[model samples]
Target: MNIWEYIYSPIIIFIASYILLRFAGKKAVSEMNSFDLLFIVVLGTIVSEPLVDKGIPSALSYGLVFTLVYILFSILTLNNKLRWLLITTPTVLVRNGDIDEKGLRKARITTDELLGTLREKGYATVKDIEMATMENMGKVSVIPKSYARPVQPSDLNLFPGAAFIPIPLVMNGQILMHNMKYLKLDEEWLKRELTRQNIAFDKLDDITLASYNAKGQLDIDTDNDEGHNHNPYMYKPGNTN
Candidate 1:
């Protein structure tokens, strides 16, 4: 086989692959319905055929044709009249805190699975749920009874501080100097804060993780912390490599 075949075949396949990826990847795997998943699985096999047989031109053509068909089918699903042909409608699994056995059987989901899904949604038991439905994407949507739901801050007329994303300032017993500089923090300030936390400045290597938030808070985890161990960093901060 000529070496040029390697470069030529890949470039042809890549153009076809990009179209499939660009359009078909709009939804995450967890969000794909049965038809969508099947289409993707079949299209993937068609795209890979070229790699196995070196049938580059024909494989690319079939791959692109199927991709366009999938896209057209997807667009048709947007219309109410055509949606029924494309996707399965949601099934009600629970109604008014009572399990709908028939609905569960229709959805092919066992009672145990329904209870587990409800638990994951933060409901301890079905008694608090007004409705639970199995969506087309295979995820459960749980709605709690209004009276049984937890109260929100709005209900108490209280405003709390906005949550801030925690920035990593240290990891694996080494300071992330870039993040510290981003936060306008210096080594002296970090040492002082560690000292205030009763951690010796000389024992920085004992720390495995540290993060700071905009709420003027410093959180630190040492090697002794659960699920962490004392592993020294291979390279110190400020290394270009």
Candidate 2:
């Protein structure tokens, strides 16, 4: 109701919410089931009531007290023995290519859901996985069998140059001046390159997208030709491949 109450109440409530979330554990919020979602909705309504209702003078004080109690209990859950009692541990859903039916039942995850997740990760069958863990956060992490894993570039002693994230230099015929500056490129340099590519400066208005990276050639697309075939090996000494 007063200035001090308006200021301190929100700060106290924010601290309380943070402490409560910390106690709830990361999984409780991230992998929220129906119960967790309901708890959060109820908690929000309860905490916010005082701020909206002019008649509730004691609500703010009560919220602060409740927050303190929550903080104390949260600290107690830090002990390893007590933590297990409060929080769900990661469940081993698959081990050595065998599905753990008991673990799936305990986690309340269906066989269909497990198979779907495995398929999403490109594993067609459980036998392809050496280990699969259902993390407390409800994410499935799979370790493929060594034979099933794809070979890395490093395994062949290949020294591919450093990777560069492509930067968009132009979109919808408009030059991205900020990106050009970030890439330490000037308008003159871009215009010169465009001219070399036979992209007339006057016809830049027809261009839709243009992007470049350190290791690759500049790419350009134009709105004028929706079905234009761009040659990959089109040669430009310094401007393109």
Candidate 3:
């Protein structure tokens, strides 16, 4: 009911929620499994208790309890016997270009819905699908028949070496010295290259992103720094100009 309670409740709860969520395991909502969803819903309810009649201490305590339970449940799901009760099994809906009517019924999806899902996955007809399965997370995964799939280099007897992930030399206008070191590059090399692109040293932060690819190419993207805004409450970085 008090203003102070309203102000402090969200701040305290946010910190608690973040810590608990990190411990609980963070991932995109779309990628969350059933147990993960349950954990999130329970956490939301527990953290929101402080906004009601309950105190922050009680809410955080309850959140910790649930997080422990989530961890235990995660461990239990790893066992084959316990896994059946914990996790939903993936169901095959199509195999060998044939639709499994029983699988469709078990998955609770209509034929029309299956057709739409196939279309979204780039398959125009069921005949093109070698296998389509309903994953535990409710995503429909489709594997096209080999003959129906796109041609690849292997099909033409061509082999290309595997590539490594792209590393960033700079990000958000700040030099990633650690990454530069990892890539065996130094500050002087990066500074010289940015100068060639007309990116002044002081204006590096205006660049939204800068990445160095495996092929020895530097990609840069910049935003209008003239429209940059700063928070009055925060300490501002010193400007060169």
Candidate 4:
């Protein structure tokens, strides 16, 4: 309630949280497994107690001590002998397009779960994947078979020139002035391009999204065809019109 408690406590808590999170490593936060999730929940409860409870004397000091202890243990776990005690190694779920049933059982993941993860990653069947690894953080990383991979423009010996990142000029009927400025483009140039495409200045509201690349490729999507179904593979290199 006091000014010191309000400001000081939050600053201390934030610093402690940041240190603890950094010590835990990136995977602990980015791709958290069941154990990592539990660790975070417990850590949150412990860290938040001192801030919430005003009756406790030396609360900030206690928090700092606890956080430092956790960081020390995290550093100790970096040793080869102690690393396995803290972190799980990645499990090979599929190898050479064959399912590793034993590995799956050890990881406590079902075949259906593995299949579902593969499908989410664009692999429809296990045979399409050369290797599927379940990372320590519980994320499925896949290596597709060479035959299943799509051909790149380079494979066809086509020099399409350097591709520039498309900058969005408009989104949901609003002009993105910041993106225009970043691309060193002005409103007059955009207006001219829109007018050339038969889009009137006042009719800009009809456009849902509009982007342009350095190669003069302008992509425009309008709100008029929300229900339109287009083939995704139609734009592929060898696809017929």
Give all candidates' CA lDDT scores. 0.83, 0.75, 0.85, 0.78
Off by over 4 Å in 2: 1-87, 202-205, 226-241
lDDT, candidate 3, 63-174, per-residue tens: 9999999888988888999998998999999999999999999999999999999999888999999999999888999999999899999999999789667777778778
The true-versus-predicted C-alpha distance at residue 67 of model 4, in Å, is: 6.1
Taking every candidate in turn, the Cα RMSD to the unseen true structure, in Å, is: 8.1, 8.9, 8.5, 7.5
Give the range where candidate 1 is weakest over 10 consecutive residues by summed lDDT. Answer: 226-235
Cα lDDT of model 1 by residue, 1-241, tens digit: 6999888777777777877768665752447898788877987789878878988778877877887787788888899999998889999999998999999999998989888888788988998999999899988998899977889887899888887889998788888999999989999999888888988878878888889967666798887643333335434356532
State every prediction's TM-score relative to the real structure.
0.64, 0.61, 0.81, 0.61
Model 3 clash pairs? 173-204, 173-205
Candidate 3, residue 161: how far the Cα is off, in Å:
1.2
**Which is the leading candidate under TM-score?**
3
lDDT of 1: 0.83
Candidate 4 TM-score, true structure as reference: 0.61
Lowest summed lDDT window (length 10), candidate 4: 232-241
Q: For all candidates, what are the clash counts?
A: 0, 0, 2, 0
Task: Write the number of the candidate with greater TM-score, choosing between 3 and 4.
Answer: 3
- Write one digit per residue (lDDT tens) for candidate 2, span 1-241: 5789888777766676666666556644666644455556656666677667743445545544654554455566679888777656888999999999988998889999999999999999999999998875568899999888888888899889887777889888889999998878897888887887789877778888889868545688887643334655544467533
